[model samples]
Target: MLRLRLVTWDVKDTLLRLREPVGLSYAAEARSHGVQLQPEALSRAFRAAYAAQSRRFPNYGRAEGLSSRQWWLEVAMETFRLSGVREDAVLALMAENLYRDYCNAHSWELLPGASETLSCCRRRGLRMGVVSNFDNRLESILLRCGLRHHFHFVLTSEAAGVAKPDPEIFRTALRLGGALPEQAAHVGDDYSRDYRAAREAGMHSFLLHGHGRSAGPEVPPGHVLPTLSHLLALIEKG
Candidate 1:
């Protein structure tokens, strides 16, 4: 029997999310400036921008503290740039506005039943920590959702000096959990970042595919648990 003592989690999309698709927030913020762009387009652009920014600033947390906001501003600008907003002035304006808008707590909410899952883990005596590719704002966000108490520590990419899928962040979480890789489990929604990365780090990983099933012959077997409730059951049974 495998002994498990620690459980580390990814924050965004795993524990909580915006009430609507992220694009809606982008659209809403853009509309205030008389900008009319499709949310779908903006969504794609935003993801691409964030990914690119990550590659450019692979060691953000080690850099100046202001790097967080600067990185986000770059991503926001890239979103507009990809959306066909060619004017530099307009792009800068949108980036600043959108960055400010995202900082507000009104833009996010806890995922359904997430609290119950965390509570269940607590009752099971599992040591929990958080590993995420987020900025400093993440601590405040978790606190607002009443999840701060459940986690023993929160490790963000901006603080770990590394992000997910890189394995460095997972290593940090393990250190915080005070367990060997085999004695801990990692949970997240991203396949590569959470599943593949944790698997490579020698930790058991659970992929939570919310709202549907995604298993296929090509997909790796025995990792998709899909719901926090199922994850809790597995940890409890172990």
Candidate 2:
């Protein structure tokens, strides 16, 4: 039997997703302030700018690093510029509003069945925590979504000073969970960061699939689940 003592999770796309497309949120907010933008265009531009930021400051809220607010302010401004809202003052107002919107829990929704699966894990007496590349706002998000109480701890890239695939975060999570790597399992949607990286860190890993998109730089998964409920089955059967 595959016995384990701890199980950690990834936040975005694993436990929760944005209530609306990030670009759409920016576009709508900007529209309310008299700045017109195409949501699709804003989304594309946001993705590009955010991707650049991710590459540049993957863990921006950590020590001596730019805050998440700063990083997203840059992304929001880039998104505004790309979507034809180039006025400096309007861009600043939109960026500030967008950043504030994301900080609140209202911006996210729980993934289908996430709560049930987590209840099952807790019922089985597993120590759980969150291992995510998200900024510190993750705590508020999880708390507002009613998922925080189920975890023993929550760790984010902001606090860890590194994102997934950098074994340090996983190691730190393991320490917090009081489990050794071999006795832990990680669940996430990203194939590289959640599955392969966890496996590489010497922990078992599960990939949340069937969400209509797959993360890149493929790798062999320890397990693939179409829904969160499937995870409880796999663990119990093991």
Candidate 3:
């Protein structure tokens, strides 16, 4: 069996995900503020805005000393501006509300089998923790989702000062767990960010490809899994 002392997880799209399309959420919130926005346009604008913000101020601008709130507000303003809404006051208020709204269970849902898998791991006496490329609000989000108690710690990109695809974040997690690289494994949905990067950090890695999700041919079959439930089986068999 693979000797696993700790199992670290990526948060979004792995353990949990947004309840609805982000654009739909944004549109509904905007409507509440008396601004009409097409969900589709808002979606596209959001994607573009998010990408631009990430490139300009990666890891929520930790290196530049920008708080997560400040960075997200910038993204929200840019998204609204791109969607043809230019009122600064309206954008500010909507962004604030949107940011607050997202830091709770209402905006997110746990993936199928997530809770059961975590519970199983806990019963097996495995140390569990979160290693996510998320903001500092991750703890709050997990708490509201009733998942906080399952983890020994939650390390976010904002807190770590590094993002996935960079091995340092994984190293930070290993340090937190007080385990060697080979004694830990990481699970996440992204091929590059979760699998390859974690392996490069000298840890075991599993790329989660749930039902109907694709694990590109480039991925080795041994490292690809269908869900968190499969992960426990694989760990046992390893």
Candidate 4:
């Protein structure tokens, strides 16, 4: 039997989802600064920019040595090129809106059975933690959602100084959780960053689907499950 030591989870798009459309809050806040933006249009632009930035990080890390936050800010700034918004102003708006949304308990909704699956892992005596490619505010988000108590450790890319698809972030999580790479597992929705990187780091990895409408690569995950609750059966079988 495989010795299960730690169970690491991803944050955004995995455990919790945004309660409202992206930039709805931002647009509201931006209106105060004399910037006119419709919620839906701003939301679409922000999401497109976010996804594009995420895709560029691995490449930028491999080449220009850019940090995740830096990458994101660049993308965010570029997204406002047509709006005639100043760089400093755009960044301030983003920071304010992101923190406001994350810290607001009503702005985040937990995934179906996320709490139950985590409780099952705890009951099984498996050390549980979170490893996510996110900014510093992830801790506040977890606390706001009452999930801070569930994880033994929380490693954000900003804290780790590296992002996913890079081995250092996963290695740091293993060290923090006191688990050998082989004894740990990572579960997330992104196939390339979460599953592929965890597998490359010698951890068992599972891919979660059905959260959003994004079309992912055709490659299969080591274990495929539609919801977090299904992970319990996979661990039991193993």
TM-scores for all predictions: 0.85, 0.93, 0.97, 0.80
Q: Mind giving the per-residue lDDT tens digits that candidate 4 earns over 121-202?
A: 8988999999997777788889989888889999987777778889789999999999999999999988888988999999
Misplaced by over 4 Å in model 3 are none
Record all residue pairs in model 1 with backbone atoms less than 3 Å apart, i.e. clashing.
none
lDDT of 4 at 228: 87
For model 2, residues 143-216, the per-residue Cα lDDT tens digits are 88889999999998888888888888899999999999999999999887889889888998888886787544
In lDDT terms, which candidate is top? 3
Give me the runs in candidate 2 sitting further than 4 Å from their true place.
61-64, 214-222
| Residue pairs clashing, model 2 | none
CA displacement after TM-score superposition, residue 220 of candidate 2 (Å): 6.7
lDDT for position 100 in model 2: 79
Kindly list the per-residue Cα lDDT of model 3 for residues 199-232, writing each as its tens digit: 9999998999875778999777877887778888
Candidate 2 TM-score versus the reference: 0.93
What do the candidate models score in CA lDDT, each in turn? 0.81, 0.84, 0.92, 0.77
Q: Rank the candidates by TM-score, best first.
A: 3, 2, 1, 4
* Residue 217 lDDT in candidate 1: 52
**What is model 2's C-alpha RMSD?**
2.1
The lDDT, on a scale of 0 to 1, for candidate 3 is 0.92
99-139 in candidate 1: lDDT tens per residue?
A: 76665677778777789989988887889999998888888
